[model samples]
Target: MKLYKEKLLSELQLKRLGEHQYSCSSCSYLDKFLQPYWNWLVSKVPLWLAPNLITIVGLILNIVTALILVWYSPNAKDGAPRWACALCGIGLFAYQSLDAIDGKQARRTGTANPLGELFDHGCDSISTVFVALSACIAVQLGNHPGWMFFQCFCAITLFYCAHWQTYVSGTLRFGRVDVTEAQVTIMLILAISAIFGPDIWSTKIPGTVMEMKTFLMITACGIAAFVAQANISVIFTGGIGKNGSSVAGTSVLSPIIPFSMILVPAFIIYQKSTEHVYENHPALYILAFGLVAAKVTNRLVVAHMTKSEMDYTDLSLIGPTMLFLNQYFSTFITEYYVLWLCLVWVTLDLLRYCYQICTEICDYLHVELFRIPHTGNTNTKRISSTSTSGNTEKNGTNIRNNKPPRSKKK
Candidate 1:
């Protein structure tokens, strides 16, 4: 008996230990970091102090930066004054930090619904467009031709699409941990360098060949292109399906879709590198024409297949075509128009994400339909029934009286 009891106790302890181990292994750092802040913000702040408010604040700051670069400052023709440039840089930095905070707050407070993540990323995307437009405005103020704005627009689109493709494919990693912090830092530095004049800024290298802005843009673009190609390869080769199945291509031409997707961007990047052309250079305009040709040829090859047969092939083709079109638009669009367009795209995306989050929250709570509770009436009725039953028992009286009690009814 003693041995059995000891064994049972030991088993209970082991079970608890296993449960604790599992919990620790599954703990998320994001939850830990954001939870406290979320609690404090919600409890301390006014109802009006919400995530959207933070987004608006960030947008306002971004717009102010753009306006300062466009209208005021003696060096508007070259860029903004050193002070205005500094202000813009500071504002951008703050905006990014707050952008992060809103999401963290949402997650920590158990409010990390899909809508919050969507709203946060949507805001981020819009902010990206705004930043690009501001750069265009600055460039225009600096006496650069209006066409340069198109280049900025293209760069933004490329970045956005690359991220989107990666997100969809589940291969999109942002920084060291596959988050967006590193990318944001890179963007901030690029913005700062542009403000300071790309040519004038130099790092610790004894003799670096590339200017700061040029190097930043090239590096960011190169990374984006590489990630995009990797996602395309995974998608087309069916190397990894969304449902975790491997798909074998039935036709020899099936592989070509992903092949072109990866190769075309690669060829463009290599061509740009060898010719010493930046992403926004006139060369991209020519490259866009070539990509369009490639896209048309690929479509023609797969055009004859049945809808179901062509589904996979079509999926592969869409990304390349979109990339080409994006590049074309970037190369051809006017600066002033591109900036506003980007801004509008960002705003709409943000709103869509917020709505999505709210819907998710409602679903999670299982409160699709509103229901009211009558706590007072239900509690009062329960209490009255209990009191009457107690009184009947004490008085030797049964309410039902189906059978006689030994001492009373008999």
Candidate 2:
């Protein structure tokens, strides 16, 4: 009996080795000046206000900003009025302020927890799309479908890569020039757009015929390539982890497969929708962007909370690239046919992915994934620090005690 208990305890310890504690390293030049403003703003907020509520408010502002852009720019080609850029700029600025303040509120209220981090990140992921699409509209990039697709793809992929780097390296890195810096640049561009009318800004570059929007797109692509390359190098070379080891196996591409596959249906649906109902409807494009943003955000929440590695895979890029290429070539294939096929593929894969993550988290916590407590609320309670540690120890004890005894007969 003594030997059995010892062996059981060992197994329990291994099973209860919970996720790595979160860590981050940031070098923000703007924060040096912005910190004082942020501190003052956070001080005015009541302590009773929850941090997640702040995140939700930020998200709503993002949606509203996108809506404003769509409403004013009914024809995607003619572009939104110059003043609309000012509204989007205001909305995005508010979003950034709210997003930054939430962490401070969490610290002030003594409610900082992993769930809060997850919630904040989830909001940021979705907000990325809204902000990107809004900026695209403000600059009139949406007038060119190719550039529009490229811009959105780069923005979304940039976000995914950042999280992917964090998940694998066990460190969230904010380089000297990061998303915050890029955002400031974008805001400046929007301000310029508002100050100088779109027609004037759309004029050819000083020395070149390329428009400012195209130049901005090119610059963005270059920056994205650099950032993606750095993260990909760290993934393949095993440079960032403790003791310099890779988090994923030799096949670094497999994990990205699921995320990429999920977008297949979205691409097809987007194409058909654009062809039929959204060709002239700019608002639908914003709505489409929001749907994708929501889906990707949900996926990231599951990935981060579960501490899963998101692989660096090219397969995920192939579908979107191919679809875009087909559009560029004006393919004869009917989009509806492809859309139906992609619908089936995406549904099956999404269900499987959700079920797998749900089962893993539930089993890890030793609790029902969707269980409603006697409290009669379905909303998920934040995983407090005490409960997290307690659950680990409790799960370990239950597993150890549940082991069957060896047969008496020998």
lDDT tens digits, residue span 361-400, model 2:
4444343432223333333353334233311212112101
User: Which pairs in model 1 have colliding backbones?
Assistant: 77-142, 115-357, 174-178, 174-179
Q: Which ten residues in a row have the lowest lDDT in candidate 2?
A: 401-410
lDDT of 1 by residue, 197-313 (tens): 533443433476654445545554565565456445544443233353322123423434543454455345324343223223322322232233222222222121111122223
The alpha-carbon root-mean-square deviation between model 1 and the true structure, to one decimal in Å, is: 21.3
Runs of candidate 2 with Cα error greater than 4 angstroms are: 1-20, 239-251, 262-290, 308-410
Clash pairs, model 2 backbone: none
- Candidate No. with top lDDT: 2
* Model 1 regions more than 4 Å off: 1-48, 70-77, 133-155, 170-172, 175-199, 202-212, 237-410
Q: Judge candidate 2 at residue 33 and give its lDDT.
A: 55
| TM-score, structure 1 vs. true | 0.44
